[model samples]
Target chain A: MDKYLNSQIAKIDTSGIRKVFDLASKIKDPVNLSIGEPDFGFIPDVAKSLHEAIDSKCYKYTNTWGLSELRVAVAAKLKMTKKSDVLPEEVLITAGASGALDLLFRVITEPRDEIIIFDPYFMFYHELPRMLGANVIVLPTTKEFWPDIEALKKNINKKTKAVIINSPNNPTGAVYPERIIKDIIDVLDPYDTLLVSDEVYEDFIYDVGHVSPLCFYENTILVSSFSKNLALTGQRVGYAAGSRGVLMAMAKLQQYTYVCAPHLAQVAALQNLNLDISNYVSEYKERRDLIYDMLKDTFEIQKPEGAFYIYPKVGDGEKVALKSIEKDLIVVPGQVFSKSNEYLRISYAAPKDVLIKGANILKEVADELR
Target chain B: MDKYLNSQIAKIDTSGIRKVFDLASKIKDPVNLSIGEPDFGFIPDVAKSLHEAIDSKCYKYTNTWGLSELRVAVAAKLKMTKKSDVLPEEVLITAGASGALDLLFRVITEPRDEIIIFDPYFMFYHELPRMLGANVIVLPTTKEFWPDIEALKKNINKKTKAVIINSPNNPTGAVYPERIIKDIIDVLDPYDTLLVSDEVYEDFIYDVGHVSPLCFYENTILVSSFSKNLALTGQRVGYAAGSRGVLMAMAKLQQYTYVCAPHLAQVAALQNLNLDISNYVSEYKERRDLIYDMLKDTFEIQKPEGAFYIYPKVGDGEKVALKSIEKDLIVVPGQVFSKSNEYLRISYAAPKDVLIKGANILKEVADELR
Candidate 1:
């Protein structure tokens, strides 16, 4: 039976994240910090809208692209966030931001096509293109986890099909600055490469505002979801905005792929647009400060500006991560995100008490490693 | 922007069903028979379960394989239905049956690998494998829409990676006999080919009981969904049961592809296992008889024993389908499912009155063509 499996299957093994999760599940009330979703639940108003959709009998498949009203609402939101004239026809509601990336990669990637990603990137930025038989070129970022523009300029060529950028960055919560966004787009201007901007954490910034690559490039594929902002990760609703030709192609592929996103969740996402989530953002920002302050003295780590993670440069991430589990703490090793094995990714999306408990245990474990 | 797309995009075009839908949207209260979903809405009990899932704050991601309880319940159901000892770990919940097929093809298909399917098949049966760069060898079915055993034996070889079969099939409402199901599996016994059984319409049989290919073959990947019997098409929840090795590979692929089925839908599906939906089956059986009786006189068609569709041989189906629109009727041409253009697929999944009206207009259109 294993012989029937393709070569792509051999390239993709179970992620290290799942291994961490399986270990965490065994510990009794472990201070887990490996989750990628918000700790918050659904908003009351969004829940009401979902109930109304159910009551009104919206339980059949919608248009493959999505419900017209939801697409229109998403397009309007993208126009404001991306600072581009996005039309409703250019938007596609997907199962989640993961689904959007899956569709986009399916449309553009071929065997050996080069796709560039900065170090300390999200997991799929490497896995998706590689699974589709594309060559994923990992470039070094600055010590502070910012994109190395010079390396990007040298590596990008005609074979580069797309370059994926996630901000606020995963594993390390360093949000890209507006000037850097412009510089990255300018570098790609010489090629037909697409800028795939993953803004799932757009609403989680602390100090500065979020800058979208779409603001500088019309060929950008902007993907974000209501999973974090509205806390509907289980509902699996997200949107992607891009050029009409590419989006139409994704939609046609979706007709056979996902069919459509969950209609109940699509309705909830429409209502979520009118929500004010400033309170959640404020809460996450305070949690970020708490985790950074507690761990900065024991480890060499940069202060995160956005997202709910802090990457600390610990020696032997996999060894330290495993050692931390014995102390009832769960953290992801940097090897799961990149080639590096000297950093650990600690998610601060849990309650402040959990973060404090987990941070102290992680520090004690690091001291033992030294 | 179109230049950025790969060659696979050009191989796919907008399906003809969408064209019929776009045309129907312009007519006032058109007797639409082109829809592939049930006219029924979500079961009230299932809807209540979803609301409970929402109210109880179940909006985070589940395991990629699905919630353990749902998988257990599905395994038990598969044990009873497939007459095999299916373990809980072998069942994977997906976004829908479509997502199951997508994952299966991604894990098995490679460029130039041969996948065999009977003609007048489900659209995805042809499109999904082809998109994955497989050579789709479409065999011919008998005039009564049964599998031609000789053709199946002739076309299958070592290059044949999988053979797809859909019972109570779409476009043609033929429920395959039990002996045919065994014979199909026996034919593939000599080769290492997998039998991909799509039983999405398993419950709509009016005469003989449903037979699963998994009863005879361990390599059978049996795919079904709650979308039809429970009328939760928009919820996008389904399950596939097969060998542990194949299922584990699919689950790992799903970790990157879908993450998990909508968690809310997974919870509802767990509760839905207790639901008795025999009434819905009895109602559809009546509708199937009504439409077959009305159209058999004017069109060359077989009596549909199961499913909610009647495929009638109309002279130039594309022209007749278009002409029926003027008379406020909508049907799908057979070209979308096969190479032939002489048959139209009429879905009787609508209300009794709509089915009568649509059938009347369809008969008049066929008479005019004659």
Candidate 2:
């Protein structure tokens, strides 16, 4: 053996979330909050659409950018959100949000390019930038888990190629306020840095409106996927949208990588994007609300403005996770997200009954730990 | 906008095959043969397995490596070929052969690492190595489209990190004879260069026994996907088996890419692997024979020994491609594969009726040119 592992690949530690999940899976009746996946089955109509698409022989390689119709649908959705003027040409559908992120990393970051990310971030953001041989500079978020404008401004430097922001943030469901988003953009605008916004959880915000970097920055690259909103995690369809220059670059990179997302999944996503999902979104909102109430009353947790998660403060994050495992409850330790060891992110995207059962079990586990 | 695209992203050219297909798609009733996809549908049992798996909620993210069971199944299958002493731990199920190849390129090639690839190769093997910021040195194949050991030896340099060989070669369908494969391995043995064997069409050989480089070389990295042999192109499941070192490196790279293949597809592929597909293979062999007979007898073209493709000499490849398009017959110009403007690679993997219809149309087109 050459003993010559690529430095970039060697730098990405195996995901701690996966490590804990592996251990949790070995335990009987473990409640899995470590996984950020939405627990809802894919929307009935969406599932039907996939079944129909598969049977219709849409099971061939799609365009490297994605199915034209699906791209058009994504463009239309973006238009509705009043983001930048997006056409099908400006969208590159990917395997998932993770895949989109990977493409963005490959397109934007050369070795030694600096990427700024907020602390207590989606851990993958940190790992991905590093894997691309980019220097990841972490700016700590405010106490509210929102983007800290001053901290972000301080981190900007000439070598910074991009800033990654996950609004309706994972691990902590802190939806960055518009003012904060604008301020962050203002700082990035003068620096020639691309703002990479991960809005996979854009549809899951509770009280606050989801703000997209696409609205304020021409250089912004938006990454989102159907994994969360459509419960299509298994289908692995998502997209990256940006200025034509960035998207074109990413599209070329995608061609050499995986060619395109699965055609059947693209068709299903196209169908779902066009159809009315108001009922599902509303139901999800209800679940989020119900889970919020239960968690606030039973455990000391910070309520999130958007996304289906709560970052609950518990002493010794790993210890709390281990204690939860004893009760067959699965939750990710905050240490997985950052060096912080006092919080755990709990997902509320499961069905109401499962949430209720899980909440009760979590409450009992917390009490025993205290 | 920053004018600096990532060096890695800028190096990849858009897929030549996909570009040809895009142009071909515009023509009505075209007898398309440019795509490398299998012409057969999923085996009935595989389709049934997929349907059942999807309905049973197997549609979730598998482990980042893959579903453990699928890896085990793949390991057992590799044992039959006696190619490598591959264990489940040495397999990482991917979205497709393309996905596996992407992972390999990312993990094995650092900036400026030189990779050797045969000319008239699968365009991706050339494109992907370049995309990783690696130097690609093309060693032209022998006159018969087989590996030229002397040419490979001349190209091997200290900077060479890997050499790619695609047996049952694309565009040419010339399977490197066993002795040729061994000679190529012996050439690489002294350099500690990684041998990447892409055997996507492993089972499609007409008469010759498949010889894996892993059979003789410990450094060989074998890449195969279910798209061809199992007729599951859209499902996008594949596996890479190699020395534990190479597999580990690929696994790390995969972690930062798409994370893992879709869980449901893995389950479907697992079932498909165990199912008897002798009928499917037999049918493909029959189609290959039929196409070979038609081309050799009617068009006076040389017959290919393996893979469902035949590259016949044509006058001015691009002109012939355009002429075929005018006649509603789509065949890939050899220029797309290389500098050769004298041949067109036609796929014979279509349904018997379609292939017959296409062959007659092709003969008419060829006669017009004559």
Best by TM-score: 1
Instruction: Compute DockQ for each candidate against the true complex.
Output: 0.76, 0.53
Q: Write model 2 residue lDDT over B110-161, tens digit each, in one string.
A: 8889888887878888778777778888788777788778988888978889
Q: Residue B313 deviation, candidate 1, in Å?
A: 1.3
The models' CA-based lDDT, in order, is: 0.88, 0.79
TM-score of each: 0.98, 0.92
Off by over 4 Å in 1: none
Model 2 Cα shift for residue B4 (angstroms):
5.2
Candidate number of the best lDDT? 1
Candidate number of the best DockQ:
1
Fraction of native contacts (fnat) of each candidate: 0.75, 0.51
Pairs with steric clashes in candidate 2: A31-A330, A33-A330, A205-A306, A206-A306, B95-B236
